[model samples]
Target: MNVLIAMDSFKGALSSERAGKALERGILRTSGHQTTVCSVADGGEGSVHALAACVKGEYKTWQCRDAFHQRITVRTLLFKEGESLCCAVEAADIFGLHNCEVSSATAATASTYGLGELLNQLHGHAIHKVLLFLGGTITTDGGLGVLQGLGIRLYDQMGNVLPDDCNPLFAFDHWDEEAFQTVRKKLGDMKLLVGCDVCAPLYGKEGCVLTYSAQKGANAMQMHKLEQQLHLLEQRSARNLMQEGCGAGGGCAAGLHILGAELTFGYELINRYVRLEQRLHTADLVITGEGQMNHQTLQGKLPIRIAQAAKKEGIPVLAVCGQREVDCIALTTYFQGIFTIQQGIYPLHEALAHTEEYLEETGYQLMRLITMTAGISHTVLKNQKVTIAEELCRKGKTI
Candidate 1:
């Protein structure tokens, strides 16, 4: 039997690829079950690493300015000729701030011009599939910058190009079309896959601007104005017959969606792009986890997605997270087993500090349980295996 282990690391953390590999190797060596590790990322962070592993893409570092115009060398993934199935992009690769300032929403404009620029350059090649990972962005500009970079011009009633700052967001009166011909023609046949979980609209209380502006350091005045601008952008985008993920990367989704991008759950895109189902079907058991396991985990996060796929394959999934919230009953429906790094007794801060040790410990314990269970059910397991194999032989593997 083979076991598959898949997991994603959140932003501000070490890469999950190492952890997935360690788990796969451990289970294989301990239980004699072949193992496959699908290192996955939902485009938040560590996305380039995940993409590189999946598509054999090469990496290049260039000194580019961040959202605040501070200099930094950002790494971009480039694939060999005809090897790219999709481009997995992280928003923070461009919007992440460093020397310019610390958490100033007013200063942190969400202009995906850099990302749009990257995509435009990629368009020069024959590759087409794109996966835009939306997370860790500092802008709340409703993706105006991205659209502008792709050659969509925004102007006011007087026909003046809108100011290039968050302050003048509400001044956008209309879009210029002749400018977008190149991008439109190029991406007419391409697939833009948005890796996002944010379902918020572009404006209002639950909208992207109001909810996210404060986090980026927008004052009350700025927040209100930003919301107004986002509302205008949303109206324009909707009139163009594109909605969904309009709130991602401060509206990066809107730019791409207007250009015919398709929206999918972040983890779903990752699982499909990484070929998780095929791996899950062959696994005897599955392991998935994240920085925290809470209600959000059940809301289209990586762990639940993995568990659901494993359930389809009749393979039980176990999760070991850094911070495990209560409500075992609710979680039981998703995972066969769940554990927090708290070790049954520890402060939240303490548990997080020792997360690596706790995860490794939990992994070893899971191995122990599997070993013990296998020993106890040796005969029953053998009989069940034969029965299953016979059924598969009769009905084929599709069922």
Candidate 2:
């Protein structure tokens, strides 16, 4: 049996490469089974690393500001597709939720200005295309900060320029398009592709503010404020607020769309670059997993996308996660089996620390089960054939 293992990053525990390698180690323990490990991500955290591994790219470090206006260095993946120079940027590395303490104040103030600054820096690099992964961001600023970083000036109702380091949605009155047009011209013919997983619109009940703000640390009152501010921005800008994925990264997608970006599924984009379909064709079984399996996994997450693709080729898919939510039974429709790596109850920190070990054990056990089941199935079929032959002989004798 040939097994293709493509595991996503385990967030704080292990990277995609490390996780896949660990699972590979255990799978190899079982004799006569071939295994292939692929580095993969869903365009969230660690997406750039995954892309870099897939395409053999180099990392270019750039100085930028974090969500809280703190100076930090971010690594951008630089690679070539044909003769065109392309770059991949993970939004989470700039303003991701994991970088800060989640609080109402942080949610209110986190900005994507640094992302804009990064893009501006890329403009001088002669990049032919930019793939911006817009997941795991903590900001709810509606991309006002991003526009500001791109030289577009935002003004308050009093006609004062709003600071770019903070969320501008609440005080935004209007923006000057002249500077933005100039910047746009500077990026002439460079395609900007925004990758996201969610399908939420820009505002209203199913939009960014209502669906994701709380997790970003907004309280009830803050959620209400953010919602109203998003609505106000929608009205002021007159952009298509109802567009699918416009609400991703807290309306960052909408802002980038205004700047002429094409929105696409993060998983699909990565798969294309990695040629996952071609890799899956040779596998007898495909195994993909994430750190956690839950309701969010249903929202076009990486593992689900992998399973969907594998299912098309009639390959059975399995998933192994550190934990599994009781309510994510729907995942079974795609996966032949879902296994958790945890062996016993432990502290969260301990569990995270032992993720690789647990994964190895799980992989070993799964392979053992598959081997045993194959033998049992063969025996059962043989027994059935023998019984049929005996019954036919008995009928012949009676005749």
Candidate 3:
């Protein structure tokens, strides 16, 4: 049997490339299944690696400053000419919380201006298509800094231009679009694709500001104030364009949406760019997992999506995870089997540090179960291939 091993890693944890290959090797040796390893990243940390593999793009490294003004070396993608892919990058990877401390909220002020810098360089290269990866952001303010970097100006209540920093949230009055006007004016056919995981709007229960602000060091009061500021920004932004991904990355998604960016699932976007379904069709089985496979996993996480896709082809999917809080019945409907890495009671830290070993063992054990159920292999038939009335997104083909 043929199989594909695809997995997504947690932030600051395993790399998808490593996890995919590890599962592939384990399945091939233990289950006698011919396997292919396909690494996937969902616009979080390993996104650069995933995109590089997908388009066979080259990595170009350069020195840049973090959110704290500390100099660091960073790598960006270089796709071929006429590729038409715009890469929307979140500044968090460069100004990650772990990378720097928030001495003052103002310390989180690098601006995606670096993103504009990348765009300028790409424009010189004659590139038009853009894929914006929005994740792991450190800023809690509305994306004014990014707009500033792109050459837009922010004005205060008095109509005086405000400075770039966290304080703009309080003093901002309106946007000046002169900077990004060049991008629009120069590239008539330019397209912006935003990679986002959250569906929350700009400011509310699920909005980016209230939900993610604390993680960026906002206190309860600060969170409240930031949420109010973003809410206003969202209202102003909504006046122009429909709120598409407003809830993504602290309303950064909303900001981009207003700027005429199209929103797509980060994983799904990567899947299309890489022809993920074509790879799935070639596999006999599929092994996929994430850090925690719970109820939320069913809500558009990479592993669940991969399982759903494979199921349409009658390919058995095995999910191996670090832990699971949801029952297996619901998950088993999509997966051939679901197993956790933890054997008994153990701290989460212990499990993460030994993720490689636990994952290998769990995969090997799953192979044994598949072997025993050879007689009941027909159970895999539970999810028979049904004709999807719409286009086959996996194949990039319209049915």
Query: Tens digit of lDDT per residue, candidate 1, span 37-151?
Result: 7888655556567767776676655454456445556676655436544455666788842223334544345455566566675566545676677765777666666666566
TM-score of each: 0.75, 0.89, 0.80
If ranked by TM-score, best first, what sequence of candidates would result? 2, 3, 1
lDDT of 3 by residue, 159-192 (tens): 8987754445656667776655654565445667
- Supply the TM-score for candidate 1: 0.75
Top lDDT model: 2
Cα RMSD of predicted structure 3: 6.7
Query: How close is each model in CA RMSD to the real structure?
Result: 6.7, 6.7, 6.7
Tens-place lDDT digits, model 2, residues 154-259: 9988999998767888788788868877876776678899888677788887788888888888899987877887778777666777887888898898888877
| Global lDDT of model 2 | 0.82
* Highest TM-score model number: 2
Q: 1 or 2: which has the higher TM-score?
A: 2
Question: By descending lDDT, how would the candidates be arranged?
Answer: 2, 3, 1
Better of 2 and 3 by lDDT: 2
